[model samples]
Target: SDGQMPQTREHLLLARQVGVQHIVVFVNKVDTIDDPEMLELVEMEMRELLSTYGFDGDNVPVVMGSALCALEGREEEIGVKAIDKLLAAVDEYIPTPQRDLEKPFLMGVEDVFSISGRGTVVTGRVERGNLKKGDEVEIVGLNKTPLKTTVTGIEMFKKELDQAMAGDNCGILLRGIKRDDIKRGMVIAKTGTISAHTKFLASMYILTKEEGGRHSGFGEHYRPQLFIRTGDVTVVLTF
Candidate 1:
C-alpha cells in the first residue's frame, strides 16, 4: 500500500471535524509493494494517524488491495478478494446516519425574496425537523444579530402549505422581517435550538503543493472563507 500523504492527512482532519466516528481504511496499491513488512508498517502508521484524530485507530479496519488489479480481475490476493474483504469491513464498520424528523427544525437560507403584500420569504431545503405555519423561528448566522420571526407561511412550488419538513425544498414567509435582514448564508431554525457562532476553535487542514493546493504557506492571520451548511463566511485563523 502507498504510504499516507498530506492529502490523506487533510482528509482525516476533515472527517474528524465532521464527526466521523468510524473509519474503514482501504490501503490501495498493495500490489506495487514487494515487501510484506512495508504493508504492516503502513497499517501501523495509519492506525496511529487515526488515533491522533480521535478515531478508534487500534481497531479500525485496514484492507490492502490494488484497485487496478481488481478492475482487471487479476491477482486475487490483492484484487477482487481484497475488495470483497474491504466491502465486508465497510459494511460491518460504518453505521447508517439517522435522519429523524424528531430533531429540531433547521433550514439554511439559500435565497431571499420580498413579497409585495406578504413579507420576506426565504427558500432552502429543510435540513431537519418540521416547520408549520405560525411556528416561531430564529434567523441566525451571517455575522448579523439574530432575529426572531414567526413562520407566517410555507410554500413549495408556488403552492401554499400548512407545514414543511426535512428533505423538502420550500420557501418560508416570515413575519416582520424585511428581505434585506435575511441573506443567503443565514439559517432559520426552531427558536432557541441553535445560536449564531461568531467564534470557535477548529482544526484546519492546509493542502500541500503536491495535492494541487496552495503553493505558498499562510500564517495565523490568514482569513479564509469557512463554509458551513449554505453559509460561507470569512474566518480568521489563529495558530
Candidate 2:
C-alpha cells in the first residue's frame, strides 16, 4: 500500500498503450495499516504514477478499503462502509460502455469444434446484436470468400439456449458447415453485415524495448502480424 507495485506500473503502461481513457484505483488492505498518513502517502504515490503515465491523476477516483474485512462481515470503517464507497466511486467515475444490442449481429470465431452428429459448432463471445436458432450467418475474413450458414442450436455452459445476444459467450451449431470449412480467425455475422478484405488503413502503436516490446523498429516492406479482434494475419507494411 506504500506505493504501486512493479507489475501494476507495467499493467498501467500496457493499458495506456491500448488507449485506456479512464481508470479507478482501489487501495485495498487499508485495515492492516494503522497509520492514516501511510494511506495518504500511498494515494499520493499512486496519483503521481498515474500522472506520469498520461492519465488524469488528480480527478481519478481512489477508493481505500479492505476487501478481506468486507468479506468477513466486519463493521469497521474499512469494511462494509468502504466497500460501498468503492462501488459508489466506480459508479460515478467509470463510464458505462455504449453496447447497442440492436446492431447487426457479429461474433469473432474463437474456436471451432466438430460434433459427430452435429455439423459444426463455433464458439465465441458475441461482439454485437443477437442470434437465435435458425438465424442465417455469414463467415467472413481471412481473405477467403464468405460462406453462409444457419444456426441450428445454441449452447452456453452445458445448457441449451434458444437465442443469444451481445456479449454472450456460447457455441452455435451450424446447419450445414463442415469442420474444415471454418476455423479460428473468422468473423460470423448476420448475413451481409461484413465482407472479406485484403487491405485496410490503420493507426499502429509500437511498444518500445523498455516496455517489453521490440528492441528495434522496422521500415516499410516489413512484414508483421496484424491482430484484429480475434484474427491475426501477416501483412507487409507500406510507406
Q: Show how many residue pairs clash in every candidate, following the order shown.
A: 0, 0
Q: Summarize candidate 1's per-residue lDDT along 1-239 as a digit string, tens digits.
A: 44678778878877876778888999888888999888888989989988987889989999989999999999988999999999999899888656659999999999999989998899999989999999999998864567999998999998999999888999999999988898898899899899877679876656567544688988878988888888787888887
Give the range of the ten consecutive residues with the poorest summed lDDT in model 2: 1-10
RMSD of each: 7.3, 3.9
Segments in model 2 whose C-alpha atoms lie over 4 Å from true places: 1-10, 26-40, 59-93, 209-213
Error of 1 at 62 (Å): 25
Model 2 residue 195 lDDT? Answer: 82
Task: Pull out the clashing pairs in model 1.
Answer: none
**What lDDT score is found at residue 5 in candidate 1?**
84
The C-alpha local distance difference test score for the whole of candidate 2 amounts to 0.88
lDDT of 1 at 175: 97
Best by TM-score, which number?
2
> Against the true structure, what is each candidate's TM-score?
0.59, 0.74
Off by over 4 Å in 1: 1-98
